[model samples]
Target: MKAIVKLVILLFCVTAFSQGQQHVEYKKVSNNLIKATYYFADNSNAIQSEGFFNDKNQLQGMWVSYDTEGNKTIIAYYDKGKKVGVWTYFKDDKINFVTYKDNKLIGVEEKALVVN
Candidate 1:
């Protein structure tokens, strides 16, 4: 995990786009925290996104999002709803990493999108 954290992870503003996400669905887990899994609006019943929210309703831990075709679109981390640490974005044959500290972008790296 330490080695992964040291790898490139960088940023793109997701705030405005996620505004409509206010309607996303989440459920309470054994820890009494919310575990959310958004679904594709279509009939595929595929998961569109997934993450956990803290007691204070803040996003925490690893959050993952999938594209319409079921391809992973992004892997992001948050603490108390603030973008922190490494975030990865996936595009056609390209991968972008965004690193953040206290919601501020610290670095960026782009490379071939590798799948294994």
Candidate 2:
């Protein structure tokens, strides 16, 4: 009886820690662009990252990353694989905005996060 009980407990533990497999879905948007979305492994229907890739498989357009809980953690922009426009990063209670021109850092801005 004790051995059976131990086996049952072990099985329960294994199932508890097992997680669903994560996957990525790709879609062609234009001749030069393909959208890729990565989903979470826990089957929560949450996206880990979403972005566009150019024909050369280079990062292009807007890219966004989120935490496991579906909170946006980073927002970035790219053009022909070069960093362009403003990128926003969420860290703790702060939001940082960084500007880039031709992959060069141009400016930076920071603001406190407001919680409702």
Candidate 3:
């Protein structure tokens, strides 16, 4: 029937729009710098990370990662986007760390930094 076809088309449009909202946006900071601007499925502002860069377009320093739930998952320090220094992992109120340099793991430590 015409009513059923209209409903099906409406549902398809809604689904396509919902999936399209998951895409991430990256804005360039300079000729070599870029930052990822995150958004929720509903297109709400989530978080943003400042991406570092080198003269040759190589990346360096802290790169952050966040959970879909809008929580920070890691604070990863990098040399040319390679893991370096304290790399942190978070779950609930607990935080774990792994030290690295030039993409090589040097040490790891796990502890809960917060209690609530």
- Top-scoring candidate (lDDT): 2
Candidate 1 global CA lDDT score:
0.82
Task: Give Cα-based local distance difference scores for all models.
Answer: 0.82, 0.93, 0.73
Candidate 3: pairs in clash:
none
Error of 3 at 37 (Å): 2.3
- Candidate 3 per-residue lDDT, tens place, 1-116, comes to 99999999999999998777755676776676666555556546665344566546566667777765667888887677677889888877678999997888899999977765
Residue 79 lDDT in model 2?
95
Model 2 — which ten-residue stretch has the worst lDDT? 14-23
Lowest summed lDDT window (length 10), candidate 1: 7-16
Q: Could you tell me the TM-score of candidate 1? A: 0.71
Better of 2 and 3 by lDDT: 2
Residue pairs with clashing backbones, model 2: none
TM-score of each: 0.71, 0.74, 0.63
Report the lDDT tens digits of candidate 2 across residue range 8-106: 999988887675557889999999899999998776478999999999999999999999888899999999999999999999999999999999999
Residue 27 in candidate 2, Cα distance off native in Å: 0.3
Clashing pairs in 1: 9-97, 9-98, 9-99, 10-97, 10-98, 10-99
| TM-score for candidate 3 | 0.63
